[model samples]
Target: MANTTSAKKAVRKIARRTAVNKSRRSRVRNFVRKVEEAIASGDKAAAETAFRAAQPELMRAATKGVLHRNTASRKVSRLAQRVKAVGA
Candidate 1:
């Protein structure tokens, strides 16, 4: 238990931040899933569009510290590759 008033406030802030981060992470995952589903469906145009939509979201996640820079880069690379493969 947080005995100090400041400590309690810090815990509340942490809880709020956790919810915000979780929402952001979930949103990113949904965007990635959309790209993957488009790829799996073999819709080249849809996959490309989904990839385009996902790129900025992934980059934003990195910028917001929701994801590591390399992780976001790797995800973008992989998604782009899948998009290209389908579009080919």
Candidate 2:
């Protein structure tokens, strides 16, 4: 479908970017899931630890344009709340 040489190169670049973004998204989800699982299991320490690890990953994804800034902030805020609640 990409008839022009430049269009073909652009398609290749898009494919590469898509793969990278997909991997980043999946990594972020795993980090979030770890925190959520820790919270659900009622392990305050583990939840806090997981939240600490996930916070930077979430922000990194946002900075790299894998996620929106507000979306990452909201996720971090909600996870922190849940982690706090786990302690109470």
Candidate 3:
């Protein structure tokens, strides 16, 4: 129900951005899940590997605006601590 062409274009852009953001968010969540699963399984090496893999994804989510930087850092920090404890 956008009367102006600019508004119509904004709606279209938002729709496209939403789809992209959804995919990014899903991918980040998947990485986080993988790390958590590895930790739950008590595989220290696997957990470390998964954490390593997830770090970049989480940071990317923050850098790309899908996640807040502090939130992403907190998640990474917690995940790293968990991995360290498991590895220790």
Candidate 4:
């Protein structure tokens, strides 16, 4: 539906960006899942380690515009809380 040349190019760029963003989002999810799985298995050390790995990934996704900053901060805070609770 892009009739103009510029419009066509814009569409192409959007497609490429979408693919990249999708990949980034999936990667973030996998990192979060690792922490969740570790928590579910009740391994405090493993959960802590996974959380450590996930925290930066979450923030990085935010920095890359894949996630909102507040959303990433909230997720990190909640995950850290859960990881800490694993020891209690």
Per-prediction TM-score = 0.96, 0.99, 0.97, 0.98
Give candidate 4's whole-model lDDT. 0.97
Candidate 1 ranges beyond 4 A from true positions: none
lDDT of each residue in 34-81, candidate 3, tens digit only = 999999999998998999999999999999999999999999999999
lDDT by residue (1-88, candidate 1, tens digit) is 9999999999999999999999999999999999999999999999988889999999999999999999999999988987899867
lDDT of 1 at 5: 96
The sequence of per-residue lDDT tens digits that candidate 2 reaches over residues 1-88 is 9999999999999999999999999999999999999999999999999999999999999999999999999999999998999978
TM-score of 4: 0.98
Which of the numbered candidates is closest to the native, going by highest lDDT? 2
lDDT of 4 by residue, 1-88 (tens): 9999999999999999999999999999999999999999999999999999999999999999999999999999999999999888
Off by over 4 Å in 4: none
Q: How many Å off is the CA of 54 in candidate 1?
A: 0.6
Poorest 10 consecutive residues by lDDT, candidate 1: 79-88
lDDT at 44 for candidate 3? 95
Candidates ranked, most accurate by lDDT first: 2, 4, 3, 1
List where candidate 3 sits over 4 angstroms from the true fold. none
**Weakest lDDT window of 10 consecutive positions for candidate 4:** 79-88
Which candidate do you rate higher for TM-score, 1 or 4?
4
Rate residue 70 of model 2 by lDDT: 100
Measured with C-alpha atoms, the lDDT of residue 87 in candidate 1 is 62
Clashing pairs in 1: none
| Candidate 2 collision pairs | none
